[model samples]
Target: MKFPSLFSPLKVGPYQLQHRVVMAPLTRMRAEKPSLAPRPLNVEYYAQRATPGGLIIAEASPVVNTGFGSPGIPGIYSEQQIAGWRKVVDAVHAKGGIIFLQLWHVGRVSHSSFQPGGALPVAPSAVAISSEFKAMTAEGKVVEYETPRALETSEIPGVIDAYREGAKNALKAGFDGVEIHGANGYLIEQFLQSRSNLRTDQYGGSIENRVRFLMDVTKAVIEVWGANRVGVRLSPYGIANGSGEADPMPLYSHAIKSLDPLGLAYLHFIEPRSSGAGRAEVNHQNVPSAMVLYRPMWSGVLITAGGFTGETADAAIAAGHADAIAFGRIFISNPDLPRRLRRAYPITPYNRATFYGGEQKGYTDYPAHDEMAQA
Candidate 1:
C-alpha cells in the first residue's frame, strides 16, 4: 500500500513536481469583490493546504471582462488583479508548494449581469445554447441564459490574446505554471463541440476548423509562458454546462495532434468515464486510446483527472497509464489528503453546504489527522 511510485519525482514540461497528487481546479466563488480580485481569505485558504511536493491549480479565473460568467470569480486581465494573485502565489510557494492559475472564459454559459455593462454573452455562433447559467438579476437571482453575439472572423484573435494576457499576469503573480481551462464546457470547449459551435468560418465546420479556437488559445498562451509552463484541461465526454459532442474521438484527436507540437508542460484530460467513487472506467468510444493515444501525440507530461482516489491514482501511475492524477472534492474536504492516503486514514465527508459561498466553515476549517485524533 506504499505510494512510493506516486511520490516519485516527475517532470512536467520544464518544471518537476514533487509528487503526483494534484489539486484539481474547482470553482469556489469567494473573491472579496465581484469585479476586484482574490483577497487575503482566498490566499489563506490556499496557503493552508500548500503541502510540499503537491501541485495546486487555483480555482478557474476569467481571462477577460466579457469572459466572466460568475460574480466574485477572480480575473487576471488587470494590474491590480495580478498583485492580488501575487500574494496567493507567494504564500503557496513560501510553503514549498507549486501553484498554477487556471485561465478561463465562459463564452455563452454566462448571464448579462456577468458581462461588461450588462451586455449580451458572446460565442462562436449567434445561436443560443439551451444550457443556462446562474447569475445575479435585478429581480433577485435567475437562471436566464441569453443568446450570445457570434464573434466575427476578425474578432477571434482578440479572444486568443486574452489568454495570453492572462498567462502573462499569471507569471507576474508568481505562479509556477498556467493551466488553460479548455474543459468543462467552457469557451474553449464550446468551440470544440459541434453542439455548441454552429459557425461556418474557419473556427467552425470541419473537425480541423472547430479545433482552431483551442489551438489559437494554446499558441497565444505559449507565447506568454513558454509552452513548457503551460497545460490544458480537456473534457472529451464532460456533460456540464450544456455540452454534448456528436463525434468526440476524431475531433479531439485532431485537436491534440495540433497541440502536440507546442510541447506543453502537460495535457490533462478528464477520463471519459468515471465512477462516482474515484474510479475511472473506459466506457466511451469517442476517446480512443485514452492516455496511450495522448502520450504519443504530446511529448510532454500526461495527467489524468476526474473521480480518482489514492489507490486508483497510484495504480494508474505504476501502470504507466498517467504521469499524475488530480483530485477535486477529496482535496476540498481533506487538505492533507496526500498524508491521509499514505496511511489509509478514513476521510471525513465534505459538507454539501458552504461549498460555494459562506464563511470558512467547511472551506479551511477541516482539521488535520492529529487534530482529529486529539479531538
Candidate 2:
C-alpha cells in the first residue's frame, strides 16, 4: 500500500488503532450557549470525521468556570456539560472511532470579563503576558486580555483538583481517555515555561519547581484514568499565548525524563513551525525537532503534530521519528481523511473565515470525498 507506515496499525495504551492518523484537537467554538455544552452540531461535526479505526482528540474544554478563555468554548465542570459530551462520545463510538477529550485551562490568557464577578484571571505568577491576546466576553463582545493575578501557593491544590474532577467527568461522559492540554501557552504551559511562571515558591524557579504543577496535574488525572490511557501535549518552541522560554531544550528534556517512568499512553508534541498562535522574534532555525530531542528520553508512543501533510507524515513514521501523526486542518476539511490519503485524492480547502463560532455552513457542511464526487 502507498504510505505503508501511515496506513499501518499501531498500539496505543490498551487500544490498537487501524492506522496512525490522529485527529488533532481543533477548537471550532460551536458549543451551546451559557452552559457551554457540546451541542448537536458538535455531535454531527465529530461524527462526520469519526473515521473507523482512527483516533480523535476532541477540542479543548475548560475544567472550571474561571478557566474559560473564550465564549462558546465547552466545559466539563457541569452536569449539563457532561451530558452534552456524552452525546458526542456516543456519536463517535457509533461510527467505531476512538475519541479522547482534551482537558484545558487558559490561565493568564483570559480576561476579567470571562471570569466570575469580573475577577482577574490567575496564573502561577502575577507577571502579565506581554503579547497581544483577545478573548470573547460573556456578553458576546471581544476584548483584549487583562492582567492576571498571581495564584496563591495555597490555591495550587485547587487547580490540580479541577483536572482530577475533569478526568472523572470525561469518564462519565463515555470518553475512551483524556489528554492533558499542557501546550500552547495554557495553564500547564504557563507553569512549565520560565517567562510566564516567575513564582519563587515550590511551584517555580528551577526546572524541577516549574514542572511541579504539570506533574501534580498529571498524577491526579492518572488516578482517574490510568497512565496508559493518559497523554500529555507539549510545545517546546511554542510562543503562542505569549509564553516562551529563553532556553527550552533543557527544561523540556528534564520534564520528559521525569515523565518517562509514568508509562503514559503517549507524548504529543507540536512542531516549531506549525505553532498556529504567536511567533517568537528570535530565529527558530536552530530549534531541533521534538522527536530528535525527546525520543531517547521517552520510549513510549509519540504523536507529532503541526503542519504535516500526508507525505511528510508518512515520512516521519517511516523514519522512526513518530508512531502516529495528528492532523488538525486537514481533518477539518476532509472528514474521510484516511480514505483520501490512502487513495491519494485531492483535498478540499477549508474556509478560514467560517472556522470559529459558526453554524453548519463551515462546521458540518464539508462533504466527504464520495459525496463530492456524487455531487
Candidate 3:
C-alpha cells in the first residue's frame, strides 16, 4: 500500500501529528470588545475544522496589555482573555485536534485610541507604517492613523516581557503550543524592515541588531513554554501595507541563525515573492526556495506556507524543505480541508464579503462535502 503523502504521520514538537497538514493562523475578528474574548461562534468554527493530522494555530492574539489594535481581535494579556481561550482549546481538543495560539503585537499598525491610556502605537523607530485602518472615536468615526511613538532603548524589555506573559497565558489556556506572529509587516516585521525601522540606535543599524527584538521575544516565549512547544512565523520578502525591505535574505538568515540555538518547534516561513506582487495570496506562483534553503541550518521542524497545493506540499515534505504545510484561507471554507484534499473533492470558494467583521454570514456558514451532498 502506497502511503498517502499528505496523510503521513509526523512528529512535530511534542505532539505526534496525524498528518503533515496545518491550518495556518488566519485572523477573523470575532472576539468581543472590552474582554476581547473568543465568542461561542469561534468555538463552533474551530471545532468543526478539528481532525487528526490537523494542527490549527489560532488567530493573532495581542501580547501586550497596551496593544488593542483591531476592534474585535482577541488578546491573551488578561485572565478573562485566557479563560476565553480555554473554552476554545477545550472545544478543539474534544475533537482530538491540537491547537496553538499565535502571539502578536501590531506596533504602528495601530491607532492611538486602541492603546493603553490612549497612548500612541509603538514601533522600533518613530516611523509610522505606510498603511491605514479604521479608528474608533467618542463623537464619531474619523480617518486617523497618528505617527507612532518610537520605543526608547530602555523600554524594550517591557515589550519582550509582554510576549513572555502571553506564552504563560497560552499554557494556562491549555494550548498545545504557541506560534509567534513575526510576519506580514506587523510589529516584529516592522522592526526587521530597514525602510520602516530607521533609527540611529543599535536596534536599527545592522541586520543583526534589527532582528534582536524578534529573537528576544522568541527566546522569552520559549522560556515560558518549553522550546519544543514554541513555533514562529516569518515573511522574509513580504511587502504588505507599504512595507519594503532593502534585503530580506540577509536579515532573515541572521534571524534564523540567532534562533537556531533556541530549538523551537518549527520555523514557519511565509515564502514571499521577490517582486512583492504576490504577497499572501498563494497560488501557482513559486517562491525562490531561499528560506527553505536554510532549513537544515536550524535544529527544529520547518513549515512553509503561502500558495501550497497537494502536489507541491507533498513534494516539499518529501524533499525535506518543510515538515508541514499551513493552509490559510482554504481552511475558512473547507472545514474538512484535509479530507477533501485526500479524496480530491471540489473545494468551496470562500466569500470575501463575509471574511471580516461579520456575525456568521461567511464565518461558519461554509459546509463540508458531506453537508453539501446532504443539502
Candidate 4:
C-alpha cells in the first residue's frame, strides 16, 4: 500500500503490469565480443532483474553491422545474435516478466573503425558531432568523431529495412514487443534534430521533412508488429551527444501530435533534466519536465524516465503527469527494484566505475534485499 499509485496495476498495450517501475533501456556494453551477441552472463543479469509482471526494455541493439558504435553491445541482424536474444527472452519469461528489445542505430556517433572496411559512419547529413563529444572505436580507443557520409536518398530504404527486419527478428526471439530507440543522439534523433540532420531530401528542410524519417521508420516497424505492441522514445529538449535544437517546442509538439493518432503502445520521454545521464551524472536545475509539457498531446500511456526516486516517481503518477516511470541507474545496482521500493528498503548506491563493460563485479553480483539482510 506504500506508494499506492506506483505499485498499482496498469495495462500497457496487450499486457498488464503489476507495478509501474519500468526498467529503462540501458547500454551496458557487456555482450559477447566479435559476435556481439547476448551471452549467458547477459542472460543471468536480465533474469535477476525480472519481476513477475514488470516491464524491462532491454538495451539498445544495433540493427545492422554498420549500426554498431560501441564494442560488445548486441545486434539483431544476425542469426547468431537472434539466438542469443532468444536465450535472454526465455530467461525473463521463465520468471514471468515482460521484456521488449530497443532497436537502435548510432548513426554519426560511430567511427570509421566500427564501420565495415573502415568506411565513415553514415547519417542524414555529413556533419560530424562537435568536438565536445567523443566516440569510442571498435578497438576501444577514445577518438574524435569523423564526419559521416550523408545517406543517399536511394539508400534510405535499406536503413529502414534494417529496422523492419530487426522488428521481425525481435518477434522471432520471443520478445513481447519492440521499442524504437528514437531518443538520445542516435540515428532517429540525428534525423529529427536540425543540428544533426542537414539533408535536403524528403528527410530534411522543413520540420515536416525532418520528421519524415522517424514517421517512415515507425510505420515500417508497425507493419511488422502492430502499433499497439510498439513504442517510440523521444527526448524533445535533450543535450545528449551534442544534440540540441535552437527551439524544441515547435519541432517536438509537431512530432508528438503526429504520433498521437497511431494508437501505439506508448510514447516514452526522457526528462530534459536527466537526458545526459548516459554520459555522466547530471542534474540540470530549472529544466522543463518533458512529461508535464507533452502529456496532453499523447492520448496513450506515457512513460517518462529520468532521475526519479521512489517518492518522486509516486508523486509523478499521483499527479497524472506520467502513467509509469522507468528507472535506469538505480535499477542497475538494485536488481530487486520493485520489491525494495514497495517495502521502502534502503537503496544501494550504484558504482559508476563498473556501470559499463564489466563482469559480475557490478552486475549480477548485487545481492537482493533479502540476501543482504540474511548476510
Candidate 5:
C-alpha cells in the first residue's frame, strides 16, 4: 500500500491527529433559531463526517446577540446554546473525532433585523461596507446589510469580554479547543483593513492598531483554552463581507509576526483565490501565495484552505509548505474524504443550491464511499 503524505499523523496543539486533512469551518445554517441552538439534524450532520483521530473545526458561531448576522446561526453565550452544542461535541467524540468551535462576530455584514432591539450593528468604524450583503432576520426574512455604528472606545473591552465568555462556554460545551474567526471581513478583519476602519483612536491608524482587536481577543480566549489549544483564521487580502486593504502583505506579515510568539495550535490561512474575485484581483499584482508569504514567518502548525485536490494537498505536505490541508466543499460531498483520498476513490459531486438553508437533503444526505460501494 502506498501511503500519501496527507495521511500522515501530526500534532496540532495538544491533540495528535491521525491525518493532516482537517474539516474547515462551514456554516450550514441548520440550527434552530429563537434560541439559535444546534439540533439533532446538526448532530447527525457532524457525526456523519467525523473521522476518527482527525480534526474538525465546526461552523462559525456568534458570540453575542448583537453579533448575530443570519438566521439559525448558533451562539455560545446562552445556556441553551451550550447544551445544544454538547450533543454535537458528544457525537463527534463518540466517533473518536476531535472538534473545535469557531467563535465568530460579524461586524458590518449585518442588518438591523438581526441586532438586539433593532439597534445598528457595531464595527471598528462607522464606515458602511460599499458591497452588498444578505442577512437573515430573526423572523427568517432575508434583508440587505445596513450601516453599522462605530464601536466606542469604552466598548472595546466589552467586545473582548464576549469572546472570553464564548471561549468559556465552548469549554463547558465540551469542545476540545476553539478557533477564533478573524478572517473574511468580520469584526476582527474589519478592524484589520484600512478601508473599513477609519477610526483615529489607538485601535485605528497604524497596522499595530488594526491588529489590536484580534490580539486582545486572542489573549482573552487563551485565558480560557490556553495558547496550546487556541487557533486563529486569517484572510490577509480577503475582500469578502465588504473589507479590503490597499496592500495586504505588509499588514499580514506584521500580523503573523505578532501572532508567531503566542505558541498557538495552528494558524489557518484562506488562500487569496479562496477569498473571492475582488480580493484575488487586488492581490494579483504583488502578493504571492499564502504559503509563500507566511511559510517563513510562522514556525508553528500552518493550515491552508482553498481549492485543493488530493494530489495538490499531498504535494503541499511533501513540500513542507503546509502542516495540514483544510477542505470545505470537498468534505461536504465526501464524508469519508480521508479514506477516499487514500485509495483515490471517486468523489461525489455536491449541489451548490442546497449548500445552505436546507434540511438533510444536502446537509447530511451525502453518503460515504464505503456506503456507496456497498450499494
Candidate 6:
C-alpha cells in the first residue's frame, strides 16, 4: 500500500508478478570452484532473495568452456553444471519465485589464460580493448586485453550453437525463462558495434548486418524456450567493458525495432549512467536515460535498472518510462528488498570490497529487516 505502483501487480508474459522490483542479473564470482558449478552456497543465496511471484534474473553464466572470462563464475555447459543450476531453480520456485539464467559469452573481454588452449579470445574482429580497460586472468591477475582472433565466417555458426546449447541447458535446469546477454562488450555486442566489428560478411558493415548476430542468437534461444519465455538485455547508450558506439541511436534504433515483432516476454536495459558497481550514479553528467529514450521504440514490457530508490522507481512506473525497476547494488545487501522498500525501511549499505568473490561473510549474512528489529 505504501508505494502503490511499485507494489502493484503486473503481468509479464504468462506469469503475473506480485511486484515490480525485479532483481538485476548480478555477476558475483562465487560459484563452486574447480567445477565452476552452483553449489549449496549459491543455492542458499538465491533462495534467500526469492519472493513469491517476484522475478530474479540469475547471474550471467558462461554457455561453454570458452565463454568464461573470470574464475569461479558458473557455467551451464556441463552435466555437473546443469544439475547444480537445477537445485537453484528448485529452491527459488519452492518460494514461488521465477528465475531466468543469462546465457553469456565474454568474447574479447577475456584473456588467453582463460581460453582452452591458451588461444587468443575470439571476437567479431581482432581489435583490442583500449588500454583504459583490463582483463582478469584465470590466476586472478589483471592484464591488458589482447587483440582477439576474428571468427572465420564458418566458425560464427559454431559460436551461435554454443548459445543455443546454453538455452537448452537452461530448460534442463528447470528455469522459468532465459535472458540473452547481448549487452556489455560481449560477443554479441562485439558484433553490434561498428568499431569493434569490421567484418565484410553478412554480420558486419550496415546496421542491419550488425544486428544479424543478435537476431540469430535470439531466434536460436526462442527455438529452445519460445518467444514468450525469453528476454533480451541491451545497453543502447552504454560504454561498459570498453564498448561504445560513436552513434548509438541509429544502431540501437534498428536493433529495437527489429526485435519488436519477436513478441518476447520483456526487454531489459542497463541505464547509461549505471553499472552493477553503483558508482555510475554519481558525477555522471549528460548521460541519456535508456528507458526514456527507447521505451517508445519497444512495444512489450520494458524493465530498466540503475540508481533507483523506492520513490524514484514508483515515479518511473507512474510516468510510464518503465514498467519495472531492477536493483543491483542495494539488492546485494538487502535480501527482503521488496518488503523493506514497500515499508520505506532503512536500507543497509553494501560493502563494495565484498561485492565480488567472497564467502558467507558478505554473501548470505545480510539479515532481513525483521531480524534487525528482533535483534
Backbone collision count in every prediction? 1, 0, 2, 0, 0, 0
Every candidate's lDDT: 0.79, 0.88, 0.80, 0.93, 0.87, 0.91
lDDT of 1: 0.79
Best by lDDT: 4
- Looking at candidate 4, what is the lDDT of residue 152? 99
Name the runs in model 4 displaced over 4 angstroms: 1-4
Error of 1 at 170 (Å): 0.9
lDDT of 3 at 80: 86
| Segments of candidate 6 deviating more than 4 angstroms | 1-4, 275-283
Worst 10 residues of 3 by lDDT: 274-283
For residues 1-375, write the lDDT of model 1, one tens digit per residue: 644467788877666778888888877777767446888888888987788867899989888888877667788888888988999999998988889989999898777876668788888877666734344442237675778888888999988988888888899889989999888777898899998888988999899998989988888888888888899988776666667687677888788888888788889887765412221223444544466556666666788876677888888888777889888777888888878887889887777566666658888898878789999
Among all windows of 10 consecutive residues in model 2, the one with the lowest summed lDDT is 276-285
Q: Candidate 2 at 68: error in angstroms?
A: 0.7
How far in Å is the alpha carbon of 301 misplaced in model 3? 1.2
Q: Evaluate model 3: give its TM-score.
A: 0.92
lDDT of 5 at 323: 87
True lDDT of residue 261, candidate 2: 96
Instruction: Show pairs that collide, candidate 1.
Output: 278-307
lDDT of 3 by residue, 88-182 (tens): 99999998999999999988777777776877889887876543533443222555666889999888899999999999999999999999988
Q: Number of the top candidate by TM-score? A: 4
Model 6: per-residue lDDT, tens digit, 1-375? Answer: 354488889888889999999999988899988899999999999999999999999999999898888888999999999999999999999999999999999999899999989999999999999998888999989888899999999998898899999999999999999999988888999999998999999999999999999999999999999899999999877788888999999999999999999999999998887742432334355889999999999999999988899999999998899999999888999999999999999999987777779799778999999999999
lDDT assessment of candidate 3:
0.80
Clashes of 2: 0
